[model samples]
Target: MQDFSQARNQVLQQIQHACDLAHRTDVAKLLAVSKTHDADTVRAMYDVGQRSFGENYLQEACHKIDELKDLEIQWHFIGHVQRNKTKLIAAHFSWVHGVDRLIIAQRLSEQRGHELPPLNICIQVNIDAQDSKDGCAPEDVIAMVEKIQQLPHIQLRGLMVIPAPNHTQAFFDAQALFKKVALAYPTLQSWDTLSMGMSGDLLPAIQAGSTLVRIGTALFGARDYSQDR
Candidate 1:
């Protein structure tokens, strides 16, 4: 296993240094992207005080959630939200970071068990309009937000983006969108999280006002896709 304690501390230090450079008093929270890693690896990360873990695959994530039931971990579904998978995602994860459509949000709201707390979600935006990306157009966000806020079981948090590598301007654009939404919906107290950045480009994202950074390879090492196959 990787030295999670040292890795986590190094990441934390980098976050702090980035925040200092940006003059941001509030440091960004790290969401360990533990998609392909096993449950034991996640448990090791949890032991090092990482409370939030982001997963891309629903089946793999659900298995880990079941195995790590005893840990007070906040699960985040960071992959493309499929219609058929929302039920399980709603029932298992605490946050959904790739909600692009109102229909997806609606299904998640309807499927989420009432006994659990409201599911926190971030609207995924294709800030750069990449053809390969799975997010809504930047222009469609306001209308989508207006409709999604009415859902009772899900709380509209903020924007999540996966801009092309070195496309630093996209990070600033996402920040602007996040601020615009927050200003427009002044009544929403939960409109706080901005899920952007990854292991490679976290510094610019944090400086651009990303509240939560999703890190994978740096902390957990390279993922083996053979098991996923």
Candidate 2:
């Protein structure tokens, strides 16, 4: 077993270091991407002060959520959300970081229970993205925001991005796009989160004003992809 508390602290320290290097007073937060890890690992990390977590797969996340219902964890759905999974996501998740389509956003908005607070959402923007990636073309961000503003059950918080690996152009491109999206929507109270960093390139993302970084292996060590099958 890994020393989760130490790993969590190391990540947090890195976050602060990045913030310092960027000269940012308001430091970016760390969202531990715990998709393949079991619920007990999450629970242990939570006990050590890590609250926010990101999960990619729905079934696995749902199981983990149920098992750890007693913990005060903010679950972020960071997967390629399919239409059929909308209802469950809307009901269970507090934040969604991969909303790439208007139809899916509408489904999530419609299904979110009225009694629950509006689900916080981040529009996924494909920056120098692969053909297999699921994100709105950068040009469509304004239109997506307009559509989401009309919906009552979900609040358009900000944008999420998965920039192509080791591509300096992609990282800078994502940063520019984050600024564009931020400026496009002037009145959204929650229009602040820029979910654009992962373990490999968190520094650039943070320097570019990313408010949240979804770090996995850096915090939890290598993943067990076999269990995902």
Q: Per-prediction RMSD in angstroms?
A: 0.8, 1.3
Q: How would you encode candidate 1's per-residue C-alpha lDDT over 1-229 as one tens digit per residue?
A: 4799999999999999999999999999999999889999999999989999999889988989999999999999999999999999999999999999999999999999999999999999999999999999999999999999999999899999999999999999999999998888999899999999998999999999999999998899999998742
Superposed on all Cα atoms, model 1 deviates from the true structure by an RMSD in Å of: 0.8
Question: 108-225 in candidate 2: lDDT tens per residue?
Answer: 9999999999999999988775898889898888888889878988888888888777665776676677677667766666788888888999887887778999999998889998
In Å, residue 190's CA in model 1 sits off its true spot by 0.9
TM-score of each: 0.98, 0.96
Residue pairs whose backbone atoms clash in candidate 1: none
**Candidate no. 1 TM-score:** 0.98
lDDT of 2: 0.87
